[model samples]
Target: APDSGGGSSEDSFTEDSSTDVATEDASTLIPPPQLGLYGTLNQLQVDVSRLPRPDEYNPAMSSVEDFQTIDIPSDIKTVAYYLQAAQILPPGEDEIRFSRQEDQLAGGLVRRELDRSIARYAAESGDTATLTMTGEVLAPEVTSLEFYYFDGLAWVTQWDSEMLKGLPQAVRVVITIRPARSANRPEMIGLTNSMTAIEQGDLVYSLVVQLPLAEPPETMGDSAMEAMGL
Candidate 1:
């Protein structure tokens, strides 16, 4: 599936859009409906890998600094295999069978790739990276599972899957990032959350990852040698 370029749009997750969240004052004035117990997964693993390297180095674009992993809580039982774009039914549309063919409203629909230029650069450089997640579901009958990305302001659903057989199932999700070719060093720090629905409540798991810029190596200079008293 093609990637959604990096930019702010009406449906984009932005800082200004986050202000629309439900506030305590507003909630007190009008109590919100109970949406079951809201919980989060205990643990999640993030693996980032570099594709291949190009013959020529481009300092203008962002490179794969490193791959970092996050260990979260393991209370909720669920697993995600691959992470990518998914199609969901449009608002106001009636939900059908849990099967992908039956329920998917569209496909190749993703909020945004982590670093747009990464993929482009990787492809051009003949090197790329991928992100995948796996977990288990503890609930007896899990109705559905949804994955989202936080773009500074809000969480946007990137993949949604309906578990037809329900519960004690394994989940997998995947997404790929290539080397960035642009000079624009956009912030790669972001948060990802997953919502799993069960009979009791929803399990919401959040993980944070920051793609730092590669630090340049320091070359020996006369000032450095003097400071060291060499």
Candidate 2:
């Protein structure tokens, strides 16, 4: 019989080799690790531009010099600005009697300039109801932008003229969004929404946004308006 003192050299060697193979196989079975710092910092880029043109009926107007300003991150998923008929005082001779001259007389003047453009855009895709943006929000270097509506109770959602048919809510709202700034991190900015639910006819706005990251957003200045001769 073989010596019973201890295990053979060949047997020990085999056992060690088995353990090493099992360790390597086990490591291979594990999934790849998730992205960490690199994922956290890098982001996709997007641009947003959804404001009414200067020569249009901007019911959101509060005063002669008052214009809506929407701030967005250079990297933005979406942005929306809303204007409602309720923002304007009640329509009637009496309402006008108490309103400022510059505000009262300018309504039809602005609508005339925008009526055709609004109609054309609405008819472009064989859709009904219409919302058109007159100002440029994207810089010359950027392309690819999307539009949406600013709902009082929800995040931005896809919008079309058909979705607004026959309702005549007289609530005119516009929104814009871009892709995420990075794989995981989205840019964020403030959305200013001012409208009246019912009476008082005063503008009420809220500013809150979460999106992908990018350059700081800025307002479309008077120069942009003058360029269009608004």
**Best-fitting candidate, scored by lDDT:** 1
Error of 1 at 45 (Å): 14
Alpha-carbon shift of residue 113 in model 1 (angstroms):
17
Cα lDDT of candidate 1 equals 0.23
Candidate 2 off by > 4 Å: 1-114, 117-138, 160-230
Number of the predicted model whose TM-score against the real structure is largest:
1
**Position 52, candidate 2: lDDT:** 47
lDDT by residue (24-127, candidate 1, tens digit) is: 11011111122111111211222223442352133233221221111222222122222222233347633322222321222211221223233233334432
Off by over 4 Å in 1: 1-80, 83-145, 159-204, 213-230
* Global lDDT scores for all candidate models: 0.23, 0.22
What are the TM-scores, per candidate, against the unseen true structure?
A: 0.18, 0.17
Task: Give a tens-digit lDDT track for model 2, residues 1-230.
Answer: 21111212111211211111000010111111221110000011112334544533344552312211221222211222211111133445353333334332221101111222222343454332112121122221111111222222222323222343211111212121223345764222212111111022212222223222212124435553332222
